[model samples]
Structure formats: structure tokens, C-alpha cells
Target chain A: MCELMALSANVPTDIRFSFSGLCPRGGVTGPHRDGFGICFYEHGGLREFKDYLPSCQSAIAEFLKSYAIRSKTILSHIRQANVGGVSLENTHPFQRELWGKVWTFAHNGQMPIEQVPQPSYYQPVGTTDSEKIFCWILSELRSAFNADVCISQVSAYLHSLCNRLNALGINNILLSDGDAIFAFCSTKLHWVARKAPFGEAQLRDCDLSIDFASVNSDDHVSVVIATEPLTKNEQWLAMKSGEGRMFVNGESSWHDFGPEIIHKKSEPTKIAS
Target chain B: MCELMALSANVPTDIRFSFSGLCPRGGVTGPHRDGFGICFYEHGGLREFKDYLPSCQSAIAEFLKSYAIRSKTILSHIRQANVGGVSLENTHPFQRELWGKVWTFAHNGQMPIEQVPQPSYYQPVGTTDSEKIFCWILSELRSAFNADVCISQVSAYLHSLCNRLNALGINNILLSDGDAIFAFCSTKLHWVARKAPFGEAQLRDCDLSIDFASVNSDDHVSVVIATEPLTKNEQWLAMKSGEGRMFVNGESSWHDFGPEIIHKKSEPTKIAS
Candidate 1:
């Protein structure tokens, strides 16, 4: 399995501190040394930085840690390469355009390539089962909606689709369309929402720490989601299997936990820290 | 008018030398400081760096100039926005996926928005006439061809559509599909192909100079295309009005100059140096 990280904020906020904690896991602290990618979405457009190199060694990844780039929504992934080769085309955080908006998706688990639906509107540029599933998901969304619809009215259908994909295999995912973020958990996922009266939080992977009370005001709210809890002191809400949630403007817009569906678990691989 | 730069090389080559010259024109030496963008194609995947900010002041652009990134094909643009706002979504070197390949297009002139065809398979995410034209071009290509066809058979139809767009207004453009670079000149464009017996060349935009003999062997060949001559010492081939050329593997594959088409030219504005 791969590691996924996502953040949503009411005001434009930087993820450098959180990203700092995750970068070490790319190779120095974890086994996911195959590749890594990240996307930042602001008012102008979405900008992506992906490298086939491990984040620990990539200069671009180092630059990102120092750039202080701020955005409203962000999605990132570090791969261990189960279904696809270690190449740029196979990098996660796959992007496409639908309804005049750029849509981005990143997945953490593998599925049966033959079981995924063939694409019509969107096609995978890489030979990965994850990318094919993303294209298939987008194609289904395009077919279901013609024009812009209220996102609140959009979650039920999405929940059903997420439930369907869960049957094939593990499906931990993070997706966004510039305006909103959608996350689905099949096995493991955790999230934390920080707002007014925020206090200090410490990273679990790195020695660095930040005091939110000193940095944030009463009006700001931010939410961060990851495959595992990223902070040590913060209370992370762990999702049950077959659970999904949507975030807009740093707040949970909708959530659902479908009836449980059974699937056999594959043997887990351990990597050195 | 804006500036365009493209490079095609038989082997992986760095464009930082040529890009250094154009960097000054982005804001310091010339006026077209609306925005700037560049794309590098390496190992069948494309990565782009664009800034809504002026290139002269953008740290990302500076990082790009310092990084010794090498690729087989590269395309870049510096915009003096005319038909679109200075936004990231409206930045040049617009990209779309067609037939599992990323197609990039950058334009230097304007066209009537109403005269542009409505898109079917592709649509513009931004409100730029240039982006609309690009989407229309991709839409047309997706409809006419379903699978891989000979490059020679494809250029004739492309020439016709470009000619049609030229009838409405100026349409100087640089386009690529990873395999090749296509350039069309409605007002001014130039190209230079360098190979064995390489000699000294000096930048027209900067005081820097390079002697190719020290860096390259006898077999290396590279083709550079720009809106105007970029070097004073090198002989540059100027493209005639309505002339178009395609480059693959550092050599010309096809070229055409259609009959003269009339479109009113607007007085050019001089940018601050």
C-alpha cells in the first residue's frame, strides 16, 4: 500500500510542516521509495510536482518544503509500486479535465485491472490499474452529470460508487476538483480538523513542531487527512472500513459508512526506517 | 507579440542556455511580462513549469534556469496577454491529453472568439482565445482520427485548419505531441538546426555565449525554434508568412506555405525594457 496525504483550508494555508513529516517516509523512514507526487490548487489553477525519485532525495521535493506555497486544497502520494512500473507516467495524483474544471485523483491500493470498467470520456495514459480505475471513475461522473450540480446532491451517488470499488480490493483514495475534496477509506485512513483556539501540534515522523495558536486566527479552519495519523498530540478520527467523507472550505460537507463488504486481505510488506 | 522557444534533439539535451536569453525578455529586457511557461518532455512523460507572475521575478523560473534538467523535446512561451487575463489557467503552453499522449500548444497572436469552433472532445478551462483555439484543434484531431496514422497524412488536414484560423487574425503558434514539434508563422518565426562542426553562438537577449564544440560530439543534432532570431552569431532561417514546419528527432519532417490570407494587423505595443 502507498501513503496518501490531503489538506483543505478555509483560508489559503501552506502544508510545508505536514509535508515535512511525510517526506522522510518516502525513503529515509519507510519502504515507499518508488516515487512521489503532490498537487496544489488555488484560484488560478492546479499545479503539480511529481518525480520518479524518492521524495527524500528529490531536489524538487526539497524546494517544495522551503517554497511556502499556499493553497486551498492539496493532494499528495508516495508510491511503493505494486501495480505499475516506477516511471513518470505511473506517478500518482493523476489529473484530467471535466466540466471545465481540472479533476485530480490519487489512490493507495491495487485492484484487478480487468475488473475496472473500460473508459469512454477519459483514458489512462499509464499502464497502472490505479490510473485505469481513476479514469473509469471520472467517466462515470461525466456520464452521470451534464452540468454543474450542487455538491451536496452529489455525495450519495459517489458513496455508492466508492462502495462498489471496495469489493474489488482496498480502495483508500483522495480526490478533488479545485472546489472540494473527497476521501474514501476501505482499510485505513485518519483525519483531523483544526480551527479557532487551536493549540500546538507535534509531528510524529520529524522533530519539528508548530504552535497553531501562534500562527492561526479565530476565523481560520483547516483539515488534514492521511492514511495514518501525522501528528502525535492531535486527536485523529480513524475511519472504519467502507467509510467516505467530503470536505469543502475546510469543513466536512458530507459523510457515509456503507454496509460492510468482505474481501480477503493480502500479506503486508514491511520496510526499514 | 509574445516570445516562443522550442527545442528538438536526437538525444536528451538541456535548453537552459537558450532559455537564459529569453528569461530577460519576460520582464527586464522586454515588455511582454504578462506570464511565462515552459514544458520538458523526457521518457515519454511531460512536466511543465508556468508562472502567472513575471518570469524575471519568479523564483521558480530562476530555479529552472539553474537546474540542469535535460530532455529530448522542450517548448516554452512568454506572454504579453491580449485576449485573456493574466491568470494561471490562461497561461501559455496549454496542455490536453489526446490518444494517451499529452499535446501542448502555445500561441503568440489573437483570433476572434466567435469565429473559433465549438469544441466537442476537449474544452478550455480558461477564458483565453488561444486556449479555445487549442481545444478546437484537439477536438478536430480527435474526431478525424481514431488511431495512430502516418505523420505525413496528418499534416495536410492540420494545415487546412490552421489556415482557417489564420483568416480570422494572427495565429503564430508552436505545438507538440511529445514525438514532434510543429511551428506556424503568421507574422514572424525563425528556426536553427545545429549539428556537427558546431561553433560559437552568442545570445541576442543576454551577454552570455557558448562554444558548442566543447560540449557536443560530431553526431549530435539539435533544432531550436523561436519567434525571432535568438542568437546573433548563428544563421537563423526565417519562416515566410503562413509558413509551417514540423521537427522530429532534431530534423524537419514536413513544411508548407499556403496561399496568402488577409487579416487586419493591429499596431504593436512597445514593452518597457
Candidate 2:
């Protein structure tokens, strides 16, 4: 299994605080040490950095920790190498250009190799089942939607596709196209939104803490989603199994359980300090 | 106008020496300070780094200078924007995947925006004429070939496409797909090959010199191409106007001029120390 994390904000926001909480899991605090990757979407452009070294030991990751690159949408992953070899090409957060926008996808769990469908337009450059599934989703989206179709119109359709993959195995995923973050939880995923009257939050993986009041203004709002909660003081809303949600401008705008599967909504899990 | 550099080698080679010679031109020695980017091909995978800051001032470029990443094929560009804004999306060495192989392109000259053809499949994410031309070429190639077609078999076709763009304006280009480096010279481009018995070479823009004999093995062979001669002691072969060439495994494998124009080949320019 792997770990996935994403951020969406009303304004450009630095990701260092949340990222610091997750980086330790790649090798020091957890066993997901195969590789690491992150994609930042800024001004309709994407910056991607990937390394085959463990995140805790990678120089690239170290530089990113110190570099204050502000972005509104971001997606990151740490791999454990279940379906592919440890390689630069097998790193998570694979990206492709669709309808003039850059689309990035990262997976957290395994899907049966035999059950994955063949892609027609987009092709996988790596041997990972994750990349193949990403390509398949893009290929299908290209066939079903035109360039003029709004991305929001395809949310339910995307949920339907994610539902099919969830049936095979664990299908936790994070996807984005510069505008919003689309999350699908088959096994595990949690999210926290911070706005006015923010308080201090302590890292769960490390001994670092950040006071949100000092860094954020009253109007600033941001939502962070991860495979596991990164902070102990914040109340992270855990998504129920087989659920899809779209986060836009620091808020959840749309959500749906696949038409085929009716899942009872679960209560939010609060991590006590 | 911008600066272009590329390398084709028989084995994986570190590009710091050549890159060091080109870095100064981005801001310190010349005026191409808009942005910089480089792409390295290693083990059938690609690593790309791009920054909006000038090469001389960018922390990312500084890290790359010392990182010592080795690869068999490399393409780099430092830009002086003409038709596009200085942003991450407008950075050179743009990349896209075709036929399950990552294709990268970097251009050093300008083309008339109105003359660029609209692409059908691949689309440009940036507003640069260079990116539009790249997408157009890829769209055309997708139509003319299939996944089964060997990349070498399509080199001649690629040259033809480049020739069309050259007619629109100055179009010096460097393109690679991990197998080889394809160069199209509309005006200025030079190259030199080094092998056994390699001698010392001094940089033209920096106060640094390297004795290749001390660093490289007897079997090492490398070809370096740039918009201008990068070394002060080497004999650089300048490509004729409207000529297309392919450098593979440290040697020029094929070359041709457009069928529409013919001219006498120019003599190699020798630079004295």
C-alpha cells in the first residue's frame, strides 16, 4: 500500500507544514519507502518532482521542504512498490494533458492486474498498474467527453468509473486538473478544513507543531486530504468506504456514492490531542 | 532568442561541465534570463527540471549544478521570452508522451505565431509559439504512424515537419525520445564529438577548465550540441541553414537538407584557446 495527500485552498498557500507531517512516513515513521513524488499546480501550470529514493533521505524532498512554493492545488504520494519496480518512471502522481489542461493522478492501493482495462488513446510509460489505470481513466474520459464539456459535469461519471475499480480491490485515489481535487475512498481517506479562528495543530508523524493563526488570515481557507490524518489536534472527517468527493476552493462542492452501491455515511473521526 | 544545449553519449554521462558553460548565459554573461529547463534520459525514464527564475539566480538550477545526475541523452534550454509571458508554463524543454515513450523538445529561436498550425490531438498548455509547433508536430506524427512504428523510421518525416516550421521563421530545435537527439538548424547550431585521447577544454563563458583525459575512460564517447560553441579550445561543426541531423550514441547517424532548398555545406569553425 501507499500514502496519498492533497491540498486545495482559496488562495495560494504554502504546503510545507502539512508536507512535513507526511514526509516522515516515507521511511522513518512508516514502511512506504520505495519512492516519492509531488505535483504543484500554480497559475494553470504544473510543477512535478519525483525521486526513486526514500522521501526521508531524498535531497529533492529536502529542497522542497525548504522551498516555499505556494500553490492552490497540490497532490503528493509515497510509494511502497507493490505492482512495479522502484524506478523514477514508477513514481506516483503521473500526469497527462487532456483538453488543454494538465491532469494528474496518484493511487494508494493495489488493483488486480488481470482486471485492469486496456487504454486506447493514452498509454502507460511505466510498468505500474497505477499508471495503467490512470491512462485508462483518461482514455475513457476522452471518448465520453469533448473539450467543451465542463469538468464538473463529469464528476458523477468519474465516480461511476472509480466504483468499478473499487469493486476489484482497494481503490483510494487523488486526482486534480488545476481547478479542483477529486478524491475517491475505497478503504481509507481523511480530510480537514481550516478557516477563521484556527488553532494549533501538532504533527502525528513528527514532533513539529504549527499555529495556524500566525500563518493564515481570517479570510484564508484550506482543505488538506490524506490517506492518514497527519495532525493530532484537528478533527479530520473520514470518508466512508466507496465514496467520491470534489474539493474546490477549500470546500467540498460535490459528492456521490456510486449508483450501484449505497453506502451509509459514517461519522467523522476526531483525533484527540 | 534563447540558448540551447544537448548531449548524446554511448554511456551515461554527467552533464555538469557542459551545463556549467551554458548557465552563465542565462543572466550573468548574456540576456536570456527569462527561464531555464533541462531534461535527462536515464534507464528508459526521464527527469526534468524547469524554473521560471534566471539560471544564475535560481536555487533549483544551483541544486542541479551540484546534483551530478547522469544520463545518456540530455536536452536543455535557457529562454529569452519573445511571444510568451515569463511563467513556469512558458519554460522550454516541454515534454509529452507519445507511443509510450516520453518526447521532449527545446527551441532556441522564434516563429511567427499566426503561421503555426492548430493541432488536432496534442495541445499546447503554454502560449508560446515553440510549444504550439511542438504540439502540431506530435499531432501530425500521431496521424502518420502507429505504436508499432520504430522511432528511427520516422526521423525523416520529423525533419520534414521541422522544415515547414523553419520556413516560417528562425527555428533552431533539439528534440529527443531517449534514443537519439534530432537537431534542426534554421540559423545557428554547432556540435563537437569527444572520445579517447580527450584533451583539456576551457569554457567560453566561465573561468573554469576541465581535463577530460583525467575524468573520462578510454572508451567514453560524447557529442555535445549547442546554439553556439560552448568551449574555447574545440573545433565545432556548424550546421548549414535548413539542415536536419540526428546524433545517436555520440555520433551523427543521419543528416539531410530540405528538398525545397540546397546549399553548400559550411566548414567546421575552429576556436583557438
Candidate 3:
């Protein structure tokens, strides 16, 4: 298993502070020393930085922390190898082009190696179950929809797919396609939304604090999702098992509970927050 | 105008030395202080490092120069930014996924932006004439052939397209599909192969010397291509106008000179060195 982190914001936001808390887990606070990667989405373009070295000791990771690349959406992961060797090719936060837009995926759990789906359109370049599953999910979406499909409709289909995979084992995942971020929780996933009247937040992994009120405007709304919550002061929402949520514009657009997603009379339950 | 550099090796080779020589030119030796990027092909996967910051001032660039990531092929560029603004999206060496394989492209020189063909499948995420031309070329190839076509046949078609674009402006380009690298020279390009009996080579842009004979095996054949030779001592093969060459396994697989390339010939002029 590995760890996942993601960010979705109404405005372009810096991820350095949150990332600083997570980097230590790669080799210091945790034993996930295989590899790590981070993907940033800006204006329909994707920039990624991946390294085979543990983030705790990686200069690439060090450079990235201070570089402060701002983006509306970001996905990051730290891997502890199970199905693949420690190599750049096997690094996490894999991405592929889909629907004329870049789509990125990161996983934090392991399933049966033999149960990995046979890929069709997108193939895994690295020998990782995470990458293979990512290819499988994207291939399924490619076959189902064209380039201009609605996000909610795509999420509807993806909800089913995420549930099917989660049934096999722990399937905590972070997926994004520039427009929105979809997070599904199987075993461990947490989220926190920072909005108007923001206050200071303290890091749980290290001795650090961020005064969000001094940096962000009142209109700025940001949501961060991770395998484990990075901050201790904030009230992080612990996702229930089999829960899949879709976030757009820094707010929850839809929340579904696997089979328990209440099918209302005319429309599906979409609780806006 | 911009600078381009690429490498294709029979075995995985470190690119730090050549990249170090090219990086300083972005600001110190040259006035191309817009942006820089480097692409590496390793085990069917692509690892790219790009920054909108000038390479001379970029910490990311400095780290990459000493990191010494090894790969079989690489493509890099430092932009002077005539066609587009200096932004992350406008950085050179753009990549797209096609046929389950990642394809990367980098271009030098400028052209009339309006003349760039309308894209079909691939679209330019950044507003640049170079990226527009790359999209056009790939879209043309996507319509022309399927996923698993012969390399020679694909090179033949690409030869015509490269020449067509070259007729418009100085369209020097480096293209790769992980397996082979295609280099086309419209204004200027050069290449050199280092194999058995290799000797010492000194950097042209910096005061760095490398003794390839001590580092590489006798059987290793590596080819380096650039806008101009990176090393001072290398006898670089200066490419002629409209000359397109396909390199596979670190050797010239097919060489074409636009109109001089015969259409009816059953065999191509493949020069093995």
C-alpha cells in the first residue's frame, strides 16, 4: 500500500505547505520509501514531477516544495512497492491523455495481482498494479463516452467502477481531469475544506503552522483530500467505507454511497456544499 | 529561434553532461531566457522536466543537470519565445499519448501562426506555432496509419510531412515514440555517434570534459543530436535542408532527403554506421 494526496480549488492555489507535511511520510514518519510523484493541473495542461527515491531524501522533492507551482487541481502519491520494482517507470500518480484533456490517477491500496483488468486502449508502461488499474479505468471510460460528455454523467459511471474495484480490497483513489477531482474511499481517506473566514491550521506530521487567513481571499475556497489528514487542528472528514464523492469548484457536487446512493423520484441526490 | 538537443542510445545513457552544456545557453551564453524542458524515454515511459523559468536561474534545471537520469532517448529545448509567451504551458518538448505509447516532440524556429493546420485529434494545450505544427503532424499521422504500423513506413510518411512544414518556415524538429527518434532539419541540426574507441570530448558551452571511453562499454553505440554540436571535439554530421532521418537502436535506420527519396523504391536507403 501507499499514500495519496489531492487538492481542488476554486482559484489557483499553492500546494507547498500541505505537501511539506506529506513528504516526511515517504521515509521518515512512514516506511513508504519506494517512490513518489506529484501532478499539477493548470489551464488544461498537466505538469508532473516523479522520482524513484524516497521523498524524504529526494532533492527533486525538495526542489518542488520551494518551487510553489500553483494549480487549480493537484494529485500526489508516495509508493511502497508491492507489485513493481523501485524505478522511475513504476512511480505513482500516473497520467494519460483522454477526451482531449489530461487525466491523472493515483492509488493507495493493493488488490490481487491476477485480478487486474486486461487493458485495451491505454496500457500500463510500468509493471504496477496501480498503473494497470488506472489504465483499466480510463479504458472503460474511453469506450463509454466521447470527448464532450457531461462531468456528472461520467461520475455516475465512474462511481460504479470504483465500487466494483473497492469490493476486491482497499481502493482509496484520487482522480482528476482538470475540471474536477473524484475521490473514492475504501479503507482510508480524509478531506478538509477551507473557505471564507479561514484561520490557522497546524501540521500533524511536523511542527509547522499555516495562517490561511493571511494568504487567501474570502472568496477562495479550497478542498484537500488525502489518505491521512495533514493537519491536526482542522476537522477532517473521515470518508465512510464505499463512499465516492465528486468535487468541482472546491465544493462537493455529488456524493454517492456505493449501493446506498438514494435513488430519488426525479433526480439523483446531489447535495451541494 | 530556440535551441534543441536530443540523444538516442543502444543502451541506457546518462544525459546530465549534454544537458548541462545546453542549459547554460538559456541565459548565460545565449539570450533564450524564456523557458526550458527535457524529455527522457525509459522503458516505454516518459519522464519530463520542464520549467517556465530560464534554465540558468531555475533550481529545477540545476538539480536535473546533476541528477544524471539515464535513458535510451531524450529530447530537450530552451525557448527564446518568438511565437508564444513565456509560461509553463508554452514550454517546449510537448508530449501526447497515442496508440498506448507516449510520443514527445520539440521544435525550433518560427513560422506564420495562421498557416498552422487545423488540428483534429490532438490539440495544442498551449498557444504556440511550434505546438500547433506538432499537433498537425501527429493528427496527420493518426489519420494515415493505425497503432502498429512498420517503422519504415511511418518514417516515409513523416518525411513528406516534415518537408511540407519545412517549406513554410524553419521547422527543425525532434520526434519520438519511445522506440525510435526522428530528426528533421530545416535550418540547422547536427548529430554524432559515439561507439567503440571513443575518446575524450569537451563541452562547447561550458568547461566540462567527459571521457566516454572509460565510461561506456565497447558494444554501446550512442547518438546525440542538437541544433549545433554540444561538444567541441565531436565531428558532428551537419544535416542538410529538408533532410529527415529515422534513428533506431542508436543507428540510422532510414535516411531521406525530401524529393530525392524515391517513392517506387522497394527498399529505403538505410545507412548503418
Candidate 4:
């Protein structure tokens, strides 16, 4: 499979440090080195970079360490190439347009062809099943709502979509439209919130640590979701199988995809810290 | 050339609507179809997807329109071949591992060979100058700090590094490590913030609009930065040439590269917003 990383903050923040730790696993530390990519949402558009090359040796990865691009929501991935070929065209974090805004998507697991249908408003540029699934989701949404519908209504529709995707098997996904982020977990997924009373954080993949207190203001609040735990020191909440969560403005909203096969929900569930 | 999209918010949000508007430009509305990528920083790690084909037709892009991966910080991009070849090896939003964290980066401008030196901790996996520059930056930071530094100190050093990069030329960039976001502008960067009094937003590339207040809570706050204005109804703050800005949590800090060249200190004149 592959690895994933995401950040949702009350303020604009950079994910370079966490990415720095997770990237090694793409090839050196682990085996997810087929390709890697990242995206940052600015006000009106999106900034993204990717490499069909392994994450461990990609120069673009190195540049991010010092570039320091900050945002309220960000997504990143390192692929191991399960279903798609190890070509740039098959890289994750795909983009498409519908109803005017640019939409982005990334996946961590594979699905059977029977799970998805052909898309209407969006189409796949590559042959990856991940891309095909993304297209199917958008087409559903376009047919469901008009261009002027409220996002909340869209969010409810998406919750149902995630449920349908979860039935396809291991549907861990990350998606955005330059405004909010929606995450779903079918297999491996985890998350954490760093806010006031923040403490030190040590990387699980590298020999680095960061003290968030010094750099964060009292009003600053952030939530992170990932495929695996990146830090050894903090508490990373694992998403129960078949669980779907929506993060908006640094807060999380969750829905159960199917409790019959998935694990039970944990107590003391917090939406946004 | 390439286009970037980012969102910084007080809450977790999705960029599907905005991305829906921007993806068409990546070969449909415009010509940035060489490749496309996106990254979303979740609670712990990141989720990224990319395709070497034009985003307009990419299936993955279509899926994102309805995918509910919500986060406060989001980044997305559509590429028009510049320094890299039209292959996956040269995709944007490259990733790597350093100091135990996954680091990601994407660039909008080209860089000279002189800007990058031999790599140490990181190296380029592609032939793109963009990747070379990314690795060089990581090498510099690794050589200077062993990955155990405080976030503030790292931010300070990054500021200096960004200043140096701005001197190179058209260094508009966005970077993250799944923790915070850092942005530097050399030329053609713009941003806007939306909060409690959020209003209607009309897309510049498509005939679509959204009134954020109808979907968001009163406490919600969001900020967006882009290379060009994505909306016709909102006011965008353009970064002065040779300036750098950093966003943490939801707030922003800016610095001028090489001491304000516009007018020597003496009660600096505020440029019209």
C-alpha cells in the first residue's frame, strides 16, 4: 500500500516537518517509494508538486524542507504502487473540475472495478483505478446538486458517498475543493489535534522532534490525519475500520460506514480541539 | 507555468467547490495540462494524489469534487510543463523523508542550476530543476540543524532561506511537513481571508458561486492564497514583488526580501490593498 498525511489548522501552518519524517518510508525506511505528491490550498487556487520517483530521493521533497509553504489544509502521499503502474501518470492526488471549483483526491487502497461507474462531469486522464473511482464520485455529486447548492447539503451527500465507497473495500481517502477536507477510513487511518497546552512531538520515522508551544499562539488549533502515526510522542487516534470523518475549519465530524464488519467507535470522541 | 490553490481556516473545510472551478483550466479552460497534484494534511499524516495527464480529464480529479476529505489546510496544483519533462518523474508536489518527517514541496517558477548544490541528506529523483532546488534546500537545513530544533527556530531559519530563494527569481512556492505551512512570494502571489461575515464568492473561471455563511458556522474563519485571483467577488491581497509570507495556525506573517526595494525605510509607505 502507501502512506498519507494531512493537516487542518485554525491558522495557516506548514507540514514540512511531518512530511520530512514520513517521506523516508517511501523508499529507504519502508517500501512506499514508487511515487509521491503533495497539495496546498491557497485562497482561490491550489499549489501542488509530485514525482513519479521515490519519495526518499525526490529533490522536490528536499526543497519542501526549507520552502515553508503554509496553509490551513494540506494533503500528501507516498505510493508503493499496488494497482497502477509506476509511472507519473498514475501518481496520486489527482485533480478535476466540476461546478467551477478545482477538486483534488488521493487514495490509499484498491477497489474492484464493479464498485465504481463511469463519471459524467469528470474523466480520468490516466488508467489508475484510484482516478476512476474519483471520477465516479464527482459525477454522482454533479447529478445530485445544482451549482448553487450549499456545501452543508453537499457534505451530507458526500457522507453517503463515503459509505458507498467503503463497501468497495479499504477506501481510505482524502479530498478537497480549496475550502474544506473530507477523509474516510476503510482500513488504516489515524489523527490528532494539537492546540493550546501543546507539548513536544517526536517523529516516529526520523530522529527529529518539535516543540509546538514556541511557534503557536494561544488561538492556534490544528488537527492532523494520517495513514500511520508519524510521531512517537503524541497520541494518534486510529480510525476504526469503515469509519468516515469530515474535517472542516479544524473540526472533525464522523459517521459510521458499517459497524457490522468495522470496529466499534471509541469513547470520548472529540470533533475539534 | 503552473497554478496553485490553498485554504487556511479556523475550521476544517473542503476545497471541492473551488477545485471544481480550477481543474478545467488545467487543459480545458487553459493549458496547464502537463500534470496535476494535490495534498491534504489531516490529523496525523497527509493524503496526496497526482496525475501526469491534464487535470481536466483526470478521473481522480473528478472524484475529489465530492470526496469529503476535510481539513483546515489544503494545497492543489495544475502544471504546465516548464523545467520538467511531461512525465511522472517530473510531477510537482514532490515528497521526501528527513529528520524522521515527511516533507513536501511544489514550485511555480524555474530556478538556475547554480541555486542547487550536491545533495547530502536529500537528492533529486527526477531531472527537473524544481526537484533539484527542493533537495538542495533540505540539504541546507539538514546540514545546519539535525532535525531536533524548535519550530520557531526552524521558522526563523526558513525565513532566511526563503529570502535567499526570492533572490533567485520568480520563486513563488508552497511547502509543508504535515505540521505547518510556509509560503514565499517572488512575483505574482495573491491571498484573501474569509470569516464570520463571509459572503458570496463567484468563480473567475466558471459561472459558479457560493455563500460561505450559509454553510459555515459563525466561528469559522478561512484564508486562501493563489498565484492569480480565483474569484470575482472577493478581494485578493497581492504579494509585493520580492516579499515572503508565512502562515501558521490561521494567521500570517510577512517579510520583505532584501530590505524594501520600493522605498528606503523612512516611514515605509503602505501600498494600497
Could you list the chain B TM-scores for each candidate?
Answer: 0.94, 0.93, 0.93, 0.88
Candidate 1 — which residues are off by over 4 angstroms? A150-153, A267-273, B150-153, B267-273
Reference-based lDDT, residue A263, model 2: 30
lDDT of 3 by residue, B19-94 (tens): 9889889999988889899988874467788888899898889888778788998999999998878887789898
Q: Could you give candidate 4's per-residue lDDT for residues A1-273 as a string of tens digits?
A: 788888888788878878888899989888998889888875334567677778889766776675677788788888988776786556778765445455678888765544566665455645677877888887788788876653434666776776666655556888877567778777789998888897889998889988899788878888888898889988889987656677766777545545524422232122121
Among residues 3 or more apart in sequence or in different chains, the pairs in candidate 1 whose N, CA or C atoms overlap within 3 Å are: none
Error of 3 at B110 (Å): 3.6
CAPRI quality of model 1: medium
- TM-score: the better of candidates 1 and 2: 1
Residue-level lDDT tens digits of model 4 in B80-171: 88675776557777765455345677777765445545555454655677767677777788779855653334766776765665555456
Instruction: State which docking tier applies to candidate 2.
Output: medium
TM-scores, each model vs. reference: 0.95, 0.93, 0.86, 0.50
For residues A110-196, what per-residue lDDT tens digits would candidate 2 score against the true structure?
765656788889988889889988998889999999897555668898888888777666678898888898899988899999999
Model 2 error, position B119 (Å): 1.3
Candidate 2 similarity to native, TM-score: 0.93
Give each prediction's root-mean-square deviation over alpha carbons.
4.5, 6.1, 6.8, 23.5
lDDT of each: 0.84, 0.86, 0.83, 0.71
Candidate 4 deviates by what RMSD? 23.5
Candidate 3 CAPRI grade: acceptable
In model 1 chain A, the worst 10-residue window by lDDT is: A264-273
